[model samples]
Target chain A: MSAFNESFRFGIRNIRKRPYRSFCLVLAAVIGSYALFVGLALKASLNNGIGRMQERMGADLMIVPESSEIEARNILLTGEPEFFYMDVAVATAAAEIEGVECATSQFYFTSLSSDCCSTRVQLIAFDPDTDFVIGPWIDERVTSDVSNGSVIIGSEVTPLSNGKVKFYGNEYSVAGKLGETATGLDHSVFMSRDTMHGILNDAKDKGYQFLNPEDDGAWVSTVLLRVSDDADITAVEKEIYNRAGGIRFIETDKLISDVAVKLGSVENIINVTLTVLLVFSFLTMILFFSVIFHERKKEFAVLRILGTSSRRICFFSLTEGITIGAAGGIIGLVLGILTVFPFNHYIENSLDVPYLMPSVAAVILYGMIGVLVTTLFGSLSSFLSTLSLAHAETYYTMRTGE
Target chain B: MAFLEAQKLVKEYNRRGKTFRAVDDIDFTIEPGDFVMIEGESGSGKTTFLNLLTGLTDPTSGAVIIDGRSLKETGDKEISKIRNQKIKYIPQGESLLSALTVRENILFPFTIGGLERPSEERLLEVSDKLGITDLLDEYPSDLSGGEMRRATIARAVINKPSLIIADEPTGSLDSANTFKVMEIFRDIASEGTAVIVVTHQKETLGYATRVLEMDQGSLKEVV
Candidate 1:
């Protein structure tokens, strides 16, 4: 062990002697690993954020769409045909099934109101007293009217003293904004049932109704029903069809398949890219160590003449490489991950997403893996260099006498 | 038994298919405390002869026995053990690891040879003996040729090996530093370690108890 320390000191001394070479080797490892680390971190954060949203989709029951071509989240966010106003009359009858609970109806809309907002604004409506499904989603905004003058806005809703938005060239006050849904719901404005009716009716008079809400006559998107908590949802779904009428019942969650596919695609690309980067890093380390040994050929030979064994010299050589690699990996991991906090803002704003901060244990685990793998790669490269050259002879050195 | 012995030591080098015999049938021995100077013109196989005794290069035929083990028969590992435990070789100019501080350079052989750990007391002892005590913190590049040589000598003796081999140990020094280095070697040999020096200067003969002159790979008593 003491012999090892001595040689390690010697190794470090040699590296310090050539400051340029040492700087270059460490710099290459840091930049490459940092790039890879940052990419992987962003991808993981996205996956985690999507997972939470999917759970909100109601994990067990499959969401069935009236049509399968469009995205489910899009349907939930804006009642597209894919999300049928599921025959609102079916809700009252569907609740009478043996295992069924009370059922309620809701309407999701992506419409431009005379409310000055240029981006599409999301809106939803539920019977203020009866809609148990939207209960958890409702905020602390206390108002008695689910009518023309009452609105529960999303977190990003701009507030004003008077209710007026110049959408379709008229005025409306954003009654309130809901807590951030991490869904684009931040840009959404909710209206009392009467307010939504007024807006839609006005559109119809203007011959500007894009969706035929009268298809169901009292148009509502998917209905949410409370089942006996213990009752199997799949069985209840079947019973509802048999007892009431043949209708497709979907669990809220099955709608997130698009997010899942998006996540998977991103993961695949990142993994492939990471694998290539790791290989390149290995090669870079190998090239760096080889050049180091080449330059210090004389010094190593001198050590051998002083009586160091081949195995000892090789061990000493690898130790130096690993030290540098480990340092670079840690520095890269820390610098690469600091963006998580900054990303908190981005996800909140643009992705309409929120992510739990990575825990201390998690970040530590990631750092450990990063440093270990990097060091192993460096060590392997140093070992390969050792294998190709005889550690003892300093043959070239003795010949040139340099 | 001689403290160090090399009998009919033959070393050959193969270049493309032709084998060049560098050390040809050289028979030599040194008793304990003997200061034997081996002199030769350049290319007379003087360096090869040092390499043979030091086990840096192996002889193709014959044997070198140091402290009773044959350099030819023992594995390279065991040869190193003998070299580090019994003999120390100081190669020509540029002998030290230039990057290490003077004390570190002096301790290099001690540590690499697996001889002993260094303590401040021992470091100061060796440094003071070679008159390089104040230079312990300085690097080889900062020193004159004489200082480097003295530092190398301090390192060679730190392990206190049974034999000291100086190959052109005084090459870069003036007559003053050269004699200063020779005086240290003579003092070390007086303390019972055999010292072998390879040099061309006749003035260096004063420090040697015995001298063998090498001419084209052969040795004989001179002066």
Candidate 2:
């Protein structure tokens, strides 16, 4: 057999001979690699969620009724279905404010969980002429404008076999489907004001009135505003609060920065934890291998007397380390996948933040990196102990016989 | 020419800031087919002299030459290669690796030296000569003391080294096994390989062509 094969066989036999020691080393690597995989996957998922949120919320400032501010934020972040209305005049006044580049209004409605709808979901109606937020998204998916009798579905919503969805005794044709935004928006449906009005009239015919008795259909839930490029966001926010009275102004940048701060705290915790785990694993491996080599000093001395070079002894030691590390790392990654992916929704809910898993390719890359680092640490730890043992005086070591 | 030579060899040790000699200025030579035995009292440095001869320890002030090259001028890797290829040192007690079978332990020298494995017939022949052919597949733990000793001797000769240096090879064996091991060494030396045995057992002197004694860190020939 080849030299490498011989060395490898010898190393494997040694590992089998000392199963308890090898297990301890492998356990160290497993803990380190598991932490690495889970921590990196979570960090990437939160960052992806934040990026998606920033991109999807195209409005610079959103003006909602003061009482519905928290509700609106929850709807945007969590996709919880809610409905509130203010005067349609809020959109007109906000549009007339200085530094306001454009203004559009969205009407919010929640469908009942009964048979009249496919599922309980948020229905958001946008004004086609002035919309800047949902319009671009619609244009990307559909070949033409969404007609009055058609609706655009979010990624999570399921349409019927006929490509239609029912709400409050009315069925609308499905126009197109939007990609995942990893926010409450993924569970929302988008339509034109005309389609929304038709739904409301149909609801009213069933004696379910969503708007105030005096308002008829002249109501809007929130007005989305895009400020001019050179305008200060804070200034625009104040102007909107002043011009559109009895409203709460939500600055998109502030909202994003707040989430980013939360994300930073989570990342710091993960970094500190990963650092602690890796350091602990590395030191434990060094200590274990040191003790193990010391106990086997006689064995090494015998090899030396049998004409084995110190370098070859070291190589054999490292091969054993690599085998232990690789086995542990692969097992840890498999466990990480099982723990992180299957409970991703639970993790997001418990954290109460935006959490979107990264792409498959990114996940695979992270796994590879984790295994490489684990193997490096394992081999490096063995090198320190083996170097001294390999170069020790063979006569003294054999005579001492630890 | 001498198959192995040591010139003006000296070995010293420092204990608690005081220096003492283990082997002092000992010059020795052995030719092919020579079975030389050195008898010494405990702590008389017979093992240290053997260590120096095998290049396992560097002399304090002199040199050991194997075949033609001086050990002092040999690099560590080259010395290891020489040890693997040309010399085999069988230390006292159980030296078989516990992790390998008797067969693997015997073949370890060839494997580590990157030499092609000896044919199965040669392996069986060596083991059969050492009376360990039946124990080839057993681990060291499963072998008795005498069986383990024979396995070590088998490993030492498997590489066909020019010289064999055994330190107290029968230190822990019964009389029957001890005489059996000594007869094997006598047979090996008769085939033109030089042999050196260090022992306190006077009975083993019967197999030696030349006998020496070590006393107070020095050697003197015995008639």
Candidate 3:
């Protein structure tokens, strides 16, 4: 056998000889690795979720009906279905305001939970000619235009086998499905204004009373506005409020900033917990190796007298540490997968924040990094103790042991 | 040429600014097949002299030359190889690793340097010579004192070194076991290997071809 192989075998034998000590070291590594894996996964999920939200809210500001500001925020942030309307003239007025680069109107309609629909979901209608927010998203997903007879479904929406979706007894061809945005939009359906009016007429024929006394097609639920890049956002908000009489403005940046603050708090907690766990595990390894060296001083002295080089002795000790670390790291990552993946939705809901798990390849990469880092640190801790013992006078060490 | 030579060796210790010599100007030599015994009182520095001979410690002045090469001039790796291949040291206590079987302990010297191990037949032969063939698979904790000593001797001689340096080999053994151990050393020396044994027992002198006594860091031949 090569010296390295013999050292590895000897290390394994030593670990087996002191089962309790090895167990303690392994436990320390496990706790540290588990914390690292779970913390990284949670942080990555939140960051990804926030990034998607920022991309989805392309509009700088949202103009909703008076007194429905909170409801509009809920719809945009969480994808909850809510409907309120203002005169469609507000879209024209907002577009005419100075510093307003683009303005578009959207109509919200919540479908009924009756047999007339496949599932109760939110229906969002955007004008294909004057749309800026949803137009680019639709263009990317659907090869053909979103015509009056077709609808684009969200990632969570299931279409019938015939590649069609039904709402209020009217069937529309499914053009495409949007990818996940980790928001209520994932459960919503998007369509052109003409298809939306057809759904409304079908709903009316099915005895639904969605029309108000003053109802006309000239009403829109919310007006999305994009301010010019060089324009001051506060000045534009003031100009919109001064120009519009019965509309509440929601700054998209403010919404994202609020979520960012919450994400920051969560990241802080995770980082602190990870730091504490790593420090505790590192200290435990150092202490464990110190005790092991003290107990094995004579053994090392004997090896030295038997023609084992000092470097070889240190390598033997380091091998034991690396073995314990790798074993613990793998076990910890397995436990992390079991804990995080099974309760993914629960964790997101409990945290009341957007969360998106990373891809399979990313998870595997992180696991490998965790094992490598743990093994490195484990060997480093053992090296500190082994270095001194290896260089000690063999006769003095043996005599002291006796 | 002498198989081993100690030339005016001196080892000193400094305590509270006072210098004490453990082995003072000790000149010694041993030829091949010499069964030598060194007897000394508790503080007479016999173990210190053995340490110098084995290159375990450097002498403050003078040198030990083995087979014409000075120990002081050799580097650690070369000295360690010499210790492994040419000389064997059996320390004064129970030195077997508790984690390994007696056979593994005997084979450890070869494994440590990645050297090709002796054949199983050779191992059995050594065990048979030491009367420890039945205890090859047993750990150090399970062996009696005499059995452990014999196992240690087997480990020492497994490489068939040219010289053996044993310190207090029978310090804790009974009269019968001590005689058995000394007779084994005598038989080993008769086969052309040099043997040096340091002890406080006068009974061991009968088995030595040359007996030396140490007092106050000086050695004198008694026979």
Q: Which candidate comes out best when scored by TM-score?
A: 2
Report, for every candidate in turn, its global Cα lDDT versus the true structure.
Answer: 0.68, 0.87, 0.85
Angstrom error at residue B143, model 1: 2.3
DockQ of each: 0.35, 0.75, 0.64
Q: On a 0 to 100 scale, what is the lDDT of residue A23 in model 2?
A: 93
Lowest lDDT block of 10, candidate 2 chain A: A208-217
Model 3 chain B: ten consecutive residues of lowest lDDT? B152-161
TM-score of each: 0.73, 0.94, 0.90
**What is the C-alpha lDDT profile of model 2 across A1-402, one tens digit per residue?**
777788789889998999999999999988888889998999999999999889888899998998998899888888889998888888888888788998999999888788777788999988888999988877777765676578999877888777889988888888889977778888899888778878888777777778853454578999999999998878877766676678888888888898889889988988999999989888988899889888888898888888888888899899888887887788778888997899988888777677889999999987987788788888898888899888877898887764
Better of 1 and 2 by DockQ: 2
Report the lDDT tens digits of candidate 1 across residue range B155-196: 788766789888888887788878877887887788888999
Rank ordering of all candidates by TM-score, starting from the highest: 2, 3, 1
Tens-digit lDDT track of model 1 for A1-402: 476676677767767887887776676566556656665565666665565555444323322234532444554433222224455556665666666656666666555544443335666666766666445556455434446655676665665556444334445665554554444445566665666676666666666664563552355655667677787888877766664453555565444565556557766876887877777777787888888776666666666666666676687778777767777777777776776555665643444333334556766666677777776766777777765444445444545446
* CAPRI grade of model 2: medium
Question: How would you encode candidate 2's per-residue C-alpha lDDT over B1-223 as one tens digit per residue?
Answer: 8999999999999999999999988999999999999998999999899989888888898889988889999888988998888888998777999899999899889888888888999899888877889899999999998889889988887756799999999887888879988888898899888999998899889999999999878999994
Ranking by DockQ: 2, 3, 1
Question: Runs in model 1 with CA error above 4 Å?
Answer: A1-15, A46-105, A109-123, A126-217, A221-265, A344-362, A386-390, A394-401, B72-78, B112-131
Lowest summed lDDT window (length 10), candidate 1 chain A = A75-84
TM-score of only chain B in every candidate structure: 0.90, 0.96, 0.94
Better candidate by lDDT, 2 or 3 = 2
